[model samples]
Target: MDDAIQTEPVRQKKQKTAAGGSKAGTAERRGTDVTRVSEVSLSSKRAATAPIAVLLAAAVLLAGCWDSREVNELAVVMAAAIDQADEQNIELSVQVYNPRTAGGGGQVGQMSGGSGGGAGAFVVRSAVGSTMADAMSKLQEKLPRQIFWGHGEVFVIGEAVASKGLREHMDFLLRSPEIRDKADVFIVKGKAKPLLTLPVPLEGNTAQTMGKLADIHLGVQVSIINLTRMLAGSARGAILPLVQLSQSEEKAGDSGKIPFMTGAGVLKNDKLIGYIDVATMRGAMWVRDEIELATVTVTPTRTERGDVTVRLVRSRTKLVPRIEDGKWAITVESEAQGDILQNTTNVDFGNPLLAGRLEQDFNDQIERRMTGAIEKLQKMNADVLGFSQAFHRRYPKEWNKVKDRWDEQFPHVQATAVVKVKIERHGLSSSGAVRPNDEVQAE
Candidate 1:
C-alpha cells in the first residue's frame, strides 16, 4: 500500500513539470511575434509619411520668392559722379543707361531715334542733398525705374568736392552693397557733369570710353579698390588720374569728340592738393611700379646717330629704404625690358655689343627723368611714391618715431635711382628700310 502511494505522487509531479515547460515556451514565442509585428508597422508608417514630407518642402520653396528681381525693372547706372554743392550739401550725378538705344541693332541709323535729340546714348540725372544717401534718394524720385549699380564703370569726384575732404563722401561708396569697389575713380579738374555729357566714341557710352582711355592712353588707373588699399597703407597720400572737359577744336574734330585724360591729381589725406602733368605722372608710375606700356625716346650717343624709341614691354620698380647716420635714404631701382620700335639710324641692333651700348644709354636717360621727378615730388613734400611706407616696412620702430615728422624729413630725404634696360627685339624691320632724311615715294 506504501509503494502504490509514493508512485502516484511521483507521476503527478512529472505531469506538472511538463505542463509548466510548454507554457513558458508558448509565452516566449508570443513575445517574439509581437516584436516582429511592431517593426513591420513602424516601417509601413515611415513609408506612408515620406511623400507628405517631400510635398511640404516643395510648398515652402514655392511660397518664398524673397530674392526675385527682374532686370527690366532696374535702371542700370553705368557711372556715378559726386561733387560738393555747398558747405552743407552734396551733389550726385548718375549716368543711367537707355536700354532703348543700347538694345537697338548694330546699325547706327536704327538707334538714332533713341539718342534723345543728339544728347548721346545716356541720360544724366542730378540731385543735391545733405548726404550721398539723401542725394541718391532725391535722384530716385525722378526715375521711373529702380537704380542698379552692378554695371557701374567709373566714379568721379569733382576738384571742389575732393578739396573739401573725400573721407566722409567715400564711406557711402565703400559701405554700399550695390556699388562695386572695382570701378575706376577719377578726380575731375572742374565740374563732373561736363565729363559725363561728353560724346562717347567707339564704346557707345562716356564712362566706357573714359575707362578704356584711362587704361590705354594714360597709365594712372585708380580703381575704388586701389584707393581703399592706398588709404589703408602707411602712405596716407593717394594720386588719382584726372579728367577734364576738353573744349579744344582739335579734340572735337578727333575721334568721337570724346574728352581726354588731362593729368594726375595729387591728394593729401583724401583732399586735392594740386595737379601733375603726364610727364611727372610717368615718374610717379615708375616709383609706384605701375608702368605697363611706355615708349622712351633716347637720343643716341656718338656710337650711334639719330633717335631710338625703346618701347617698354615689361617694367618693374623696387624701393629700398635704408637709414645711415640717423638719416633716411631711399634707393629707387627700375628694371625694364623693351624692344626697338623705331630706329632712325642704322645701328647694329642685332649685335650684342651695340645693343649693350644702346641699353646703357636708355638706362641713363630713364634714370635722369625718374630722378628729376623724384626731386620734384620731394620738393613738394608729397609722399606719392610711398617712400614713407617703405621706411615703415623696413624700420617699423624708427618709422613710428618719425611718423609725425615725415613731412619735415621728406623734403630733405636723398633719393638715388638705378635703371637697367634690355632691348630684346627690333620688330619686323630689322634694319632701317628708308635711308636717313630720305623722303618716301608715294605708291
Candidate 2:
C-alpha cells in the first residue's frame, strides 16, 4: 500500500506539469492576437487622419485677409451735404471722423464746446461732379483712406439744391446699401457744407447735435424714410426741418453761430416750393398730428386785462373726411389736456363757469391756428398735411377719381377746425397771487 500511494502522487505531479504547460501556451497565443489587433488599429487611425491634417494645413495657408480693410485705413463718414455747385455740376461734402482726434480726448471734446473755430473733431472734404454718384466717386479718389458710409447719420441739403430737386440725391441715398434709411434729413438756409463745418458746443460733432435737435421735436422732423413715405404717398407733399445759423449777439464766427430750427421747408413734386414760419409750422404740426410739446397763450373773452398761458400735457388730432352730395370736406377734430402755466388774468380757476370760459377760449385759439394753417396750405396748393391720404382712406373711390386733380381740388375743399380742450390741472393755488379778492373774477 505504501508503494501504491507514492506512485499515485508521482502521477499527480506529472498531470499538474502538463496542465501548467497547456495554460502557458494558451496565454502566449492570446498575447500575440492582442498585439496584432492593436497594431492594425493604430495604423488605421493614422491613415484616417492624414488627409484631414493635410486639408487643415492647406486651409490655413490659403486663408489671408486680402479683402479685409483696417479701421485706420478707412475714412468714416458721419454726415453728408449736397449742394448745387453750378448748373452743370453738384458738390458733395462729407464730414469724416478723424481717427487722430480719437483717444486724444480733450481736443475733440473741447471742439463741441469751444467758442472759436479750431481744428475740429471732424474734417470736411468736398468734391464736385455732374451727379451725386459721380461726386461720391471723385470724393473717394480725393482721400487716401477708403470712404466708408456705415456711420452716416445726417444728410443736409442746401436750399439751392433742395429748390432744384431732391430726386437725384434721394435716389442715390436710397439705393446705396450702406446708407441708413432712418438718417435725419435737413434743409439748411445756406450752403450745407457751412452747416457741417460749424462747430457745435453740445455734442461730439455737428451731426450728433443735429440728430439730438431732431429728436427733441422742436420743429418739423423728417427722416429719409419719413420723406420717402410722404413723397410716395397719395399727397406727394413732404416737409423738412429748416435749419439756419443762429444770429448770436457775439460774432465769434461760425463757432458762435448755433444751428437752430427756424421753420419747415415745403416740398411739392419733390421740389421745395416754400417755407412756413415757426408759428405756422406749429399750426401745421397740429393738423399733421405731430405736436409733442407746445405752449398756448390766449386772452379770455371775459377778461380783457391780461392773457393766460397753458402748457399742453397731452394733445391728439384726427382728420375726419366727409363726403356729402359730391362735395369733399375735412373736419379737424382735436382733443387736448393742459395745465395752467401762467395766469395774468384776474380769475379764479376754482370757478367752473370761469374755467369753462377759459376752455372755450383755448378751443377758439386752437381753431384759429388750425384754420389759418389750413388756409395757408390751400393757398400754396401743397398737401403736406396728408389730407389726400385721409380722404383716400375714408373714400377710396372718390379719392381715385380726384387723385390726379388733388392739387386743384385741395384748395376748394373746405376744412373746419373743432378743438376740445380740458383744463385738467390749475396750479396749486386757484387764485392769482398778484390779483387780490377784489380783482379775482368769480362766477
Candidate 3:
C-alpha cells in the first residue's frame, strides 16, 4: 500500500514537468514561424506606379501660366511728392526707378557717385489734375509702363498741399489696393518736388535713406496705418516728421545733397497748423514715449557754466489723467537711466550729494521738455500728445461729451509733469572727461 502511494506521487510530478515543457515548446515554434517581408518586393509595386507618377509630373509641367506678367513691363515707383499747382489743380510728382541700370532697381537704385552731374538714381514725372486719381491717370499717360505702386517707399507732401488739407490725399492712399501701408509719410517744409529731384549723395536711393531716418526714433515713425487709426479714433491730432533739403555748400544749382529731418509737423483737422522745432520736438517725443535715444544737457546753476550731457539708455514715460469736479487734467511721470557721456563741468560724480544735485537738474530738464511740448500743443490747440485718448480710455463718458468741441477744450486741459533720472555710470572714468585737480569742486 505504501509503494502504490509513493508511485502515484512520482507520476503526478512527471506529468506537471511535461505540461510546462509543452507551453515553452509551443512559444518557440510560434516565434520561428514568423517571417519578415523583403524590401525588394516593393520594387514591383514601385514599377507599377513609375509610369503613373511620370505621367502626373509631365501633366503638371506641361501646364501654362494663367496670368504671366513680365517684370520689364512694370514701371517701379519709389517715392511720390504732392504739391499745389493752381487753385483748381493739384500736382503729383512720382519718382520712377530706372530698372535698366544697376540691376534695374533705381534711377533711384543706380546713383552715379558722390557727385551731382549724372542721370541720378530716379526720374521725377509731374502731372496736374483736380484729384489724386486724375493726376495718376494723367501721369500714367506719359509713361510707357504702368505705375507700379507696390514699390513706393515714401510719400512727401509740400507745405502748400499740407496747408490746404491732407484729407483728400490721404483718402487716395487709404483706398488704393496697390499701395502698401508700410510706406513712411513726410511733410516738406517747402515744395516736395525739388526734394525728390535732388540727387542723393549717401545711398542708392533717397527713399531708402529717408526710411532709415524714420526708423532712427529721433522723430515720429508714423505710417499710413498709424495716421489712419489716429484720425479715425478720438486722438486730438497726429504728427509727422518734417523733412527739408539741406545743401552742403548752399551754392546756387549746386545740388550737393543732404536731407535734414528738421522737426515735427503738427496737424489739426487733417491740416498742418504749425511746426514744432527740433528743440521742442524733443519735448514732444518725451510726451509721446517715443524716446529710443536721447541726450539731455543740463546746466545746474550759475556756478556750473558748462553743460553735462547725459546719454539716455532706457527711458519710459507714463501719463495719468484724472477727472476732478468735471474737469480733466493729466499728470505725466517720466523715468530714465543714463550714463554721463560728456561733463564739461567739474562736478564730482563720486560725491553722493553732488550726484544727487546733478540728478535733480536732469529731472528739471526732462520736466521742462514735457511741459514745453504740452505748451506748444495747447497754443496750437493740436493734441498730438493724444491726451484726449487717455481720457477716452479711462473716462469714456467724459470723452463722448467733449468729442465735438474737443479741439477747443484740448487747449484748456491742465497738465503736470514729474521727471526722475538716474545716472548709473559715469562712462569709463569717475569724473569729467577733462578734469583738473584744482578745477574739481568739493561736494
Candidate 4:
C-alpha cells in the first residue's frame, strides 16, 4: 500500500513536468520512478525469502522421519512359523534373511544342522511366549536388528497351533502396520520349524518357494487379508494350504529334505477341525471357483480301466440360494471347458456321439466330486464355500433369523450340484495314437 500510494504522486508529478517543465526535469522525474519501482521489487523479494527458508528447514527436519528404516538396520523376515510350545506358551519361528548376502539374485546360504553339515540358507530362530506378540518379542530379543515383515512371504501354523484357536493369536497380524496383506497363510502337517529349516533345491527358502507355488496356481492361495475376509464373510470358515516335509530323492541328510504342498486344512471358526486329501481338496476348490490350472482324470464308464485326462482350461461356478416353504436350499451350477490331453479309451472322442458321452461322463465326475466335497463340508458343519453368504445376499431378512443357528441348519440344508463340461479340443490326433490302427473304432 505504501509503495503504491507513494508511486501515484510520482506519476502525477512526472505528467505535470512533461507538460510544463524542461526536458531535464522530466528525465529526473523518470529516474525517481525507476528507483521507487526497484525499491518495491526488492521489498517483495526480501519478504518471500523468510517463508522459503522455513519450508526448506521443515523438509530437512522431516527427511528421515516417516518409515525410514534402512535395509541394513532391519532383519528382513522371509517367513514365520508358529507352533505350540506347551499348554500355556507358544513357539514362534522366523526365517530372518541374512542382510549380509541377501541382496542380488543368488540363493542365500545358512547353517541349519551345523557348520559341517549340508549347506542351507537363511537363519531360523525360535522363541516361546504366551501370545503371538509375546513370542515375537522374545524372538526379537535374540536378534541384533528390528524384525521387518514387509518382505515376509508366508506364515506357517504348526499342526498343534492350528488345532488350537488361531483367532486369539491373530491380533498382531491384524493390527500391525508393517505386515504385508499378501503374505500367504499355511498349515503344516508337523512342526513348522522343521519345514522352514529344510533346504529346498529349486528355491533356497521353502516359504518363498511356497509363495511361488501359490502364484503358479498349483494350490489354493489364501493370503492373510483374504483369510480374514473369508472368515468374516458369510462363509464363517476357511481353508489353508497344507505343507509337509518330504524326503529328498537323493538321500536322507540334513540338506536333503524338501517341503511339499500336499493338501488343504479345514478350519471352522478359526479352529482346525479336520484335513482334506488333495483329490478332495480339488473338488472343494472347484466349488469355490479357485481352480485355475488342474488336470481332472475321469473314466468314461465303470468297466473301462483306461484313464481320460482333461486339462481344465477354464471354469466358473455360481451358488444360488433360496428359501422355499421355510426350507433353505442352495444350487451350485458350474460350467467348465477343457482339452483332452490324454484319452486311452477305445472310443474316439472326435465323433459327436462319443464326445457327447464323454461330456456327460465328465459332468458326472465333476458333480460327484462337488457332491463329495459338499458332503464333507456339511458333515464337518463348515461353510467354506460361502453358501451362507448367498443366502444372506438373497434373503437378508430371513438370514438374520437363522444365522445364529447356521451350523445346525447347514448340515440339513438341501444342496444340488450341477456341472457341465465341454471338450473344446482333442489333441493333435483324432484318435488315441497309442492304440493299434487295426483295433481302432472309427465311430
Clashes of each: 0, 1, 7, 3
lDDT by residue for model 3 (9-79), tens = 89999998898899989987776654223345577789999999999998998797766557789878888
Candidate 2 overall lDDT versus native: 0.86
Model 2 TM: 0.81
Candidate 3 vs. truth: CA RMSD?
A: 7.6
Give all candidates' CA lDDT scores: 0.79, 0.86, 0.81, 0.82
Model 4 segments more than 4 A misplaced: 1-67, 101-109, 114-120, 302-305, 434-438
Q: 1-443, model 1: which lDDT tens digit per residue?
A: 99999999999999999898899889989999999999999999999999999999999989968977788898789888888889899889888776666566333212122113333356777889999999999988878889889899999888889888888777888899998988999888777865665555467666887789777845688888788777666657788988765554554442335557777888877778888887888888888898888999987684345788988989999999999999889999999999888977666566666777789999898888788778877776778888988998899999999898778888887899899998888888655667552432111
lDDT: worst 10-residue window of model 3: 109-118
Give the least accurate 10-residue stretch of model 2, judged by summed lDDT: 109-118
Candidate 1 residue 258 C-alpha distance from true site, Å: 1.6
lDDT of 4 by residue, 1-443 (tens): 99999999999998987777677777889999999999999999989898999999989997776758887898788888889999899998888776444565435645444112233357778888999889888878878889889889989999888888888767778888888988989898768877777667677778778888788877788999988887776656999999787778886676777776788999988889999887778889888888899788888773255768999899999998888998889888999999999978776778888788888888998898889988988898888877888888899999999889888889988989999898899998756777887765666
Candidate 2 to native Cα RMSD, angstroms: 9.8
TM values, all candidates: 0.81, 0.81, 0.80, 0.83
Off by over 4 Å in 2: 1-70, 109-118
Sort order, TM-score high to low: 4, 1, 2, 3
